[model samples]
Target: MHSRAVFMLLAAFALGACRGPKSDCEGSYESWTGSMAAHDWDSAYELLTPEFKKKVGSPKRMAAYMEDSWKGSKSFEFSPFDIAETNAGVCTARGEMRYTVKIRGELPKDHEQVYFSYVFRQEKDGLWYIELPGNERIQSF
Candidate 1:
């Protein structure tokens, strides 16, 4: 009876461990975007893959680039319209986002709307990380 109980417990744990992200892809994408929208660059950078970090040089450089691009932004909004995952541990999220940038020395704000698609890959650690293109920005953007 003791051996049976131990086997059952191990089986349960194995099953739970095998359960991976499917619908949760959107959730992961939201967490990353939320960090960026809040200007929490460090938190946002943590969601990227190691390859992306190496390509960007370092976390500080990545943050600086984001700051420069979003310099005059007053508000940002993002909504994921579609999220898909493959059995190979690759996922893609497509969304529409807008940023309201306050023009320097001007009263008016510039609203830029962009459609973006991001690729995420699940690594050996069972955590999903953002996979960015060589140019950084999404192709549709």
Candidate 2:
């Protein structure tokens, strides 16, 4: 109940504090995180940029990777984010992400806050999508 309240407040703050492209980025990002938190890999995969999907190969592979990657994850919420648009269609958001991770046979770790900087690209369709690093090895993306 407490976590849900916090999530609601964060969602309100994230959705309420913007206009224009940044708003779109925030919305897309919120959707992405929400899907991931719900373990809706199919929806999350659909939000990734085509380029990212190509790099990751099929949705099945992406799901497999995310399944392993998110094994200990509980919930996640974004802090205030700032977007910088360098190129016409590219932008980057810098902020903190708070989440929980539970290790097997251990007490759940809660409210782990970490700084995050992520790239976003607005496709020709005028929708923002996640863009991972060019190198596939980086976990940050």
Candidate 3:
């Protein structure tokens, strides 16, 4: 009876800790965007895949390239993602997001809507990292 109770306790802990891939990815993506909205480039950069950072160059360069994109972005939010998962466990989540940016010399309370695709890859440790995003080099502005 004691062993069964211990097993139940362990199972409960495990289940509680596992938020599932979609939830985890959503949290990570939201956190990344939150950092970008706050203009914490390095913090946002850290959430990207290693390969993306390599392709985009250092964090400073990436920030420089994206500065304009974020500079006028007063606020932003994305809709629910349509997540696609492969048998190998790779997932790509895409959604349309609205941005409030400075268009031209004026800062608008609302701007155009854009699309962002979050490419997710599971590492050996079974943790997923966002491999790419439409806001990044993968898609056009």
Candidate 4:
């Protein structure tokens, strides 16, 4: 009976810890998406890993890429359609985004919508960050 009670207690703790971390991760991703949707480049870039920031070289270059890919936009939003996580701190997220943008006029138009999937890994700081495949092969400058 004592052993069974101990097992139950350990199981409860494990479950609780798992639940808490998952929720926090979800919240973090949500915040990340929100910042990106608003084109808050600084805020979104702040959430990126040091390696990612370094790879992009500077905020100016990063902004240029982001703007080119997402320019003249009125609004952008992401809805997480799926998420998968493994015990090794590797995670994958799939989502769809809607963006409203203007090509050259004052009135914005919904021109691009895409479904994206991202792979992330937890850093030493225990924060999840995006890691792209073949990122090393791509030179920033």
Candidate 5:
């Protein structure tokens, strides 16, 4: 009887561990965006789904691209947020993101604005990853 009780308790703990962190889809996206603002490449990569990292192939490559994209700007920021969920519980999010960068030999800072959307799904592991709505491309900063 004690052994059976122990098994049940372990099972309960396992189930609880499977539950993902308490974060809405938009919140997750914003967390990633915040990482970008701080130029925290590692933190930004951590926010990506494993699938996304696979698609990008390398953290160094993604970080280089992000740096290139923002080279030459000031007061860069992104704002406005929207999130929607499908009947199947999949989520779609849209927002305006901004950035400021200064490139080599540039006299003035450049600001960039992007209107973007992301589709997300809960993996069997109960974690959410960013997936495209239609295309398989995992878009990220």
Candidate 6:
């Protein structure tokens, strides 16, 4: 009986380890930003919540915007900091991005720095997704 109880305890511990920690929300955000910096729009878009997709119009439109905005950029960097949870299933991530753009033939090159705050929602699937700025109540902040 004692050996059986020990086995059960070990099983429980293993199961808990398999479930991982609750910090996946931060991991998701990091993955999303990494995708964006790599110019992998499809992967980045996949990280956005359904509601955000609707507000942004469409996946194609989102990709177009990314392409246009980053056009002619030599390098892009996004540093996410101050990630905190605001409520259940809701978290906010603030960051700054810097990129350099090379202009052709006459126009001077431009270097841009932008500060951003984004909301992320933890869905029923236990994954976090970006909540974009929109008419949605999630954007009230």
Per-candidate clashes, comma-separated: 0, 0, 0, 0, 14, 0
| lDDT (C-alpha, whole model) for all candidates | 0.69, 0.69, 0.63, 0.63, 0.61, 0.70
List where candidate 6 sits over 4 angstroms from the true fold.
1-23, 56-58, 106-113, 134-141
Top TM-score prediction, candidate number: 1
Give the per-residue lDDT digits (tens) of candidate 6, residues 26-91: 877676666666666666677788777776777688889888977777576777778887888888
Model 3 regions more than 4 Å off: 1-23, 103-109, 134-141
Q: List the residue pairs that clash in candidate 4.
A: none
- For the record, the alpha-carbon RMSD of candidate 1 to the native fold, in angstroms, is 11.5
Report the lDDT tens digits of candidate 4 across residue range 3-101. 999999998656333322123456546646665666656555655656787888876776677778667776777778877774466666778888887
lDDT of 2: 0.69
Q: Mind giving the per-residue lDDT tens digits that candidate 3 earns over 16-135?
A: 333223235555656556665666666566666666767778879867866866777867776756766643546666787787867687647675557777767665656566765553
lDDT string, candidate 1, 1-141, tens digits: 999999999986564333322235666677677666776666667778767778778779888988897777767788778888854667788888888777768785656568887888776777787775443333322
After superposing candidate 5 on the true structure, give the runs of residues whose Cα lies further than 4 Å from its correct spot: 1-22, 87-89, 109-113, 132-141
**Winner of 1 and 4 under lDDT:** 1
Q: Residue by residue across 32-123, what tens digits does model 5's lDDT show?
A: 55555666555565556677778777879878876786555456477757676653536667777665555677656454567877676656
Prediction 2 TM-score vs. true: 0.70
How high is each candidate's TM-score? 0.70, 0.70, 0.64, 0.66, 0.62, 0.68
Residue range 1-141, candidate 2, lDDT tens digits: 999999999986564332112237767767666766666676667777877888788879878888898888877777756866756666667888788889989999876558777677788788888765443223332
